[model samples]
Target chain A: MKIYFPNFFQALLLIVLFTGGSAAFANEKSFIDEIKGADAPFDNRSVKLVRPVTLETVLAKEEYQGGAFRVLARKQHIERYKCSSCHVPGKPVLVQQGFELTHGDVVINHGRKGNELSCIDCHNQEDRDYLEDKKGRKIDFDHSYQLCGQCHFRQKRDWLGGAHGKRVTNWAGDRVVYNCASCHNPHSPRFEKRFPATYSVPLN
Target chain B: MGFTKKDKAEKIIEDVLEKPSSRRTFLKGASIAMAAGSAALATGCMPSGDDSSSGEMQLRWQEYFKKHYRLMTQKEKDETVDRLERLAKIQDDIDVQIGTEPPIENVLYGYAFNISRCEGFMECVTACVKENNLDRKTNTQYIRIFEMEPGKLDPSTGDGQFYHKVPVENKFYMGVQCFHCENAPCIKACPTKATWREPDGIVVVDYNWCIGCRYCQAACPYFGRRFNWGKGEVPKEELTTKQHYLGNRKRPMGKMEKCTFCIQRTRKGRLPACVDACPTGSRVFGNLLDPDSEIRYVLKHKKVFRMKENIGTQPKFWYFID
Candidate 1:
């Protein structure tokens, strides 16, 4: 006991130094949170008080940059939306003059190079309007990405995480990205080789 | 190899006596002559009248002597931009807008090229030419998409002049542009303090400050810079009216210009023309600081490499394969 604790003031000093220093370090560590992805969802909480963008955040009072972004809706751009318009309820086939003219040319080359799929594989045979997943869950045309995610899950993961696809309009505010169907045709996905376009064409 | 006094005197005499000199020496001599002439003209050269012609002359006078874009304050920038707009209207009958938008905070821009996706369509080249007001007469292109075979990724082994159908079997495409290197040798090579990197990692050249020495062109390992051989003319109607002071604005002949990642567009939160125009979605651009940005995701999840990265250029531009 004597060897361990001779001077009371010295003991107090050591205790104060160790405990106080450790507490400060713990606080700093929690604040910084330098772990792999403490800010994975990227809420901007880890962002310290630095930029003038802080002022914009305070003024806008909204979702921070890179926090809330969405995939652009494809329903409006789709030529044959509300598939119920053509494929009426309980009608096996609408067999109209314009129907074949509009969509008769859609060739199935989607999975020709790999695990081949038929029309009924991804398309719901029961309902012509909706796309079904492997589990037969109906996915809206607007959210066809959900249908795509069912098979191409790797690409889906990257697309959802802000890679593998193009962003539209702007980069900063309300990041809107393109859906898979926007670039790749649902039926024929392969791109053909073509002559490169140029504005000047000076190299002729 | 050191220059002694005798050698220095001989070099100076050679520099002065050389009639048709090198591009660098010519620019230095011309600038000195212009300075002397301007000093003489500074005292009451113009007639004192508010005539429309006098007003035009006054604008020209200020423009000819305007300070470098970097040194100008916000008010000075606005004044210069205004003066330039007026001068374009009066001299060329072209309505133009020159902006001076500064770099945004926390927004370090980066670009990613998907080597697997690019079909060598040259659409980015077309878009860059139109968007950046490139010299149509000379067909000055800022972006070059090279058609390369599968072996080596080096551009020298690739062909940029392919006009045939793209995505030729067993061939891949790579793009080359001003990499906007963090340690840009072009910036160091510039004798005038004209070319410098913006805060957002874009290396920009102040056209007014450039003396047309072409040192930056020779200094770039990627052969990225373009020198204006002559005034590359664009039809007045074909001119892109919206311009940035240090970007796509009409450039006088003999100055240096290169890609600014479409600064006028990118600064406004829009994608660069090349990225937007790519049909294959091969070009990805976004803020490097944002972890959720597509560029950041590519940097994390993709197999990536940079051109001449071993030279310590530290280019923000990266090429990747899925």
Candidate 2:
């Protein structure tokens, strides 16, 4: 009789666990739908035309070498991680089960009170493929500069004017510049302090 | 041997003078005879001291008699380029391209340095050295980055030889090169008109015409010139085969050289090597006539200052703080 009661309770628990998991998944889908329907202020089109005439465009037109603009897509760089492989399409939990994070090597020392900010703050919650702007707009990984420009408007203005950031490829040709993420890691935006190249010897 | 050769040459000149026709013809014939006698004597003495081949000798003579770069006709310039290519092939066994690319119209090059951003990387200095094909033996670097203390405007007090970790406490870096000043004292100092400012505001030196008097060097307040005391030691493998006639085509010993703002690259709408090499985006270069250029923007917005402004050299290069 004792063995029979425990066996009965185990069966009941299994049924409850399966049903609860499926119900939670259904709720998560509905939540994603609700978020998608919400109005986002910024779109890809608006983001692109924010600055009409950048310093790069001006220089590029003057030189006019039939150059094209290019940027590295985030998906290309972060494909190995496979965030969707472990993370389900729903709100993230404080602690995940059956998934051991091996990315401890990534150090985040950016922003005030760095530990308070998490990956989800800048990263999209519903979609792992793109980043999220303050207005909850889905930004492509290639256009992460737009995401960075939200809070760093002054820097963005200077960068647009050619006062900050580095220009890649030919300076006079088509203006293909490196994204902000190319030089500074989004998690840790500050440049690492290191020694520069060797000094030139002076004529004695 | 030298005394007998001189006597024979003199005797030939005397004979030519004695057989005088009209004044003009006699003088011309006499000069021609003297030249032939001297040429024969030189060939005779070749075995003793002259190791150069006859082809090389002819090339050297042509190079010596070549007109100034600015004055050379198109045909003369083409011939000179051919001669230089052949000389490079014969001497170094390397194929070299020497071209004369003129400056673009309505383009006066200007440079702006952001003092706040320069981290004393010295990348620009090395790039300038390699691109300009400067003499490594004499450490002929055209650019100097001065590490100066904050709250100080005196460049004389800055240390150019600091070999420590850069961005030192309370210090900023400022780089100086040939500013190509409008009121250039060096141009005024040249006795033979070997150096002059181009239409594009670049002060260029005709290597063949310079007499190496060092007058320009003395007159430059910014120490913007270098004298080649010995043959420039560029490794055969490291030789930049792409060269410009008045720019980096290997200069001979005893000629004064200064920066031409990378004429070979700039004339083709390409940034100078230093500008491309800078990692910090501290150096800005553009056409001063372009109202929308980065350099023009910096000039209009930033608090720009020029070195030695009191002296009124009117340098095209400007320094600014963002």
TM-score of each: 0.78, 0.73
Chain A TM per prediction: 0.60, 0.57
Angstrom error of the Cα, residue A102, model 1: value is 2.9
Model 1 over residues B1-322: C-alpha lDDT tens digits? 1113325644564455444647746565666576556545653475655345556666766677666676678999999899989988887888998888888766678899999889988989988988888888888999988889897899889887788887899999999899887668998898876888777778999998899999999899988899876686887777888889989998989989999998887787778889888888889998776677788788788898999877866677889987
TM-score of chain B of each: 0.85, 0.85
> How much lDDT does each candidate structure score?
0.75, 0.71
- lDDT at A95 for candidate 2? 48
Best by lDDT: 1
lDDT of 2 at A136: 95
> How far out, in Å, is residue B271 in model 1?
0.9
